[model samples]
Target: MNDQPAADTARRLTTQEAARALGVKPATVYAYVSRGRLTNRRDPVGRGSTFDAGEVEALALRSRREAAAPAGELSVRTSLTLIEDDRYWFRGVDAVELASRYPYEEVAEWLWTGGPRPGARFTAPPEALAAARRAVAALPEHSGPVDRLRVAVAAAAVTDPLRFDLSEEAVLGSARSLVPTLAGALLELGAPAGDGAPVARELWSRLTAADPEPRALEVLDLALGLLTDHDLAASTLAVRVAASARAHPYAAVSAGLGALEGPLHGAAGRLAHRMLVEVLERGGAAPVVAEYLRAGRAVPGLGHRLYRGEDPRAGALFGRLADLPQAAPALAAARDVTAVMARHGLHANVDLALAVLTVSCGMRAEAGETVFAVARTAGWIAHALEEYQERPLRMRPSGQYQGPRPPQPLP
Candidate 1:
């Protein structure tokens, strides 16, 4: 066998390739995309973005990675889709369509069950869910809601007798119990727990905007459905990696949660909201792009790993902007930045839309990541369940490093 690898098949890249070739990140390539300065076309296979080979070469001449990067073998293939590009499809249904049209709860059912809602009504055991809900409800009102939610999950796993079962029914029930309960806990802590209501509904009410339009549930369902799962993101990958080891659901969720807490995964939504305001407050659209460029930061909501040019999800959510009149300030900023930035080569993603959603709904600025945590828990659970049943190996690899051969002295 030859030691030298064959030429790479990834000759043509989309924005990311060009960006990589440009000695910058993909988001910078997004700047060029938004500017329409480079030549690009659709990825014929999945209808995502594709980069031009010649353009990539041109930019690669100046790239830092041109010589240092070496080609390698493609090793593992798994059922998970990490680094998902373009559309988020679950069981072959487009996630963008779902999030735009369905209620959040309905989306949860679909994600947890991996099947459309069958019967008109169904019931899960209330005991675990109620306990989980009560636990979350006790968090301090001013505490980080997401952290409190994670703690409640850990507590519930410790308290519950059935946490180790890992059966399909058990996992599903746990999901139904956990998500609703987490949301409820936040609401109760924010307002008053068990004041006079069923906990789940109270949380949902708090999560949603006060003046929802007639189609609010439909919109939430669709959004939740859209976000519930995508190809394996970093958070999803962490969940799947944990699950691949037959880790407990709580453990898997914890791994995923840790990943999501990073700025790369969960901070985008809040950043978009804040950035839009900063742009508007400074000097409208004129200074927004320049400020980001000077700071060497990408416009938060405008670029994506999967969407080559315009993010389809962004377009879908943009369609809903008309429904929210109260978000004018943020909207104006979003519109101005989007308009100006597109001239350079970027399109908004779910983060941008969600930022708009948060602003329009009168939701607190801090709630963006919390909402994401709530929505993404379903996927984490599903992946965990899949890992519990499917993978043969748990984990075995360990590190070997140079060290003193002598054993450590006892204290």
Candidate 2:
């Protein structure tokens, strides 16, 4: 064996060498250092910064892994929605065009059956609605809308004897009942019963006590249609996973509801709503944005990963909100936040638009999240129906083992 120190044997690379290994420029290597994605140490011979060769190689490997298809990433075939060029399509038609012209129920029916059922309306079965309401009422008085929704879904599931039938027709039947059950169950404790209005009208009653204006009600309906589905979102993935295991539609929806509790997912709108309120209170977006930056929190409602430009959903909603006199202030606040964030290449997202609606309508901060859950229920059901058509357990992915070898002595 060579008589050499371990430290001496460890290879070190100059900045240029590290950059070459990483397939990036020297400045990019330093940029990586600044981002805490890589580390550098001063060269012992005063040749500027040096990187551990092992670390550089590891980073290169990681970069390649990230640039390529991620390990265990599954490619699911879906015909329901397509997102490209910063715009989305549902069943080969422009989603914005479809949502703007059609009621939410019609759009949802089209998503499920691949054909427009114009003038479609979803009404909850009396028994299912009653069961859901009872379950929602049992929750703690302070329970948020999403919490009530989850409980309501579970109770509604108990009342459906045909929930186990995985046939497309039966699943569609459950979806029609479940979506309205979710909305009807959230009726405010003392609110009057719905008069069989559209889903948005019924939902509006629960979200705020203010009477629904004609234009505002239109915006709400448009929002429900726009939010009906996005291909393979986190909650939809959860629903698909549950469905892959042969879970009933109700259980699959519950899994999706559970996934929505994450702040990065369904709760993002609530953060945006609170930020808008703060901007209104402070009289400007500058201070609120500065505080968010100082606290290292991403200013919510500013960017979306899928869209490099303006979010189409935000663009659509903002276009309509401009027509409402009452929405002017909140709309201005959203624009101010967008203008401030534009310097960083961020644009307003749907959450900001939804916040504008909730804020202007006298709704609470959580109202956006409530709207998201109720709207996304249609999406979860769509994904569940798709999953049910695939082979059972098709989504199960084998784990990449990284632990010590099994031959090691038992601990």
| Candidate No. with top TM-score | 2
lDDT of 1 by residue, 56-170 (tens): 7765553333333333321222332343456556545566665565555666566665567732122324555566667666777675656676776776676567677777777
Total backbone collisions, model 2:
0
- Please, what is the whole-model Cα lDDT of each candidate in the order they appear? 0.63, 0.87
Q: Provide TM-scores for the models.
A: 0.69, 0.82
Q: Considering summed lDDT, which 10 consecutive residues are worst modelled in model 1? A: 72-81
Query: For model 1, what is the C-alpha lDDT against the true structure?
Result: 0.63
- Residue 28 displacement in candidate 1 (angstroms): 46
CA error at residue 25 for candidate 1, angstroms: 45
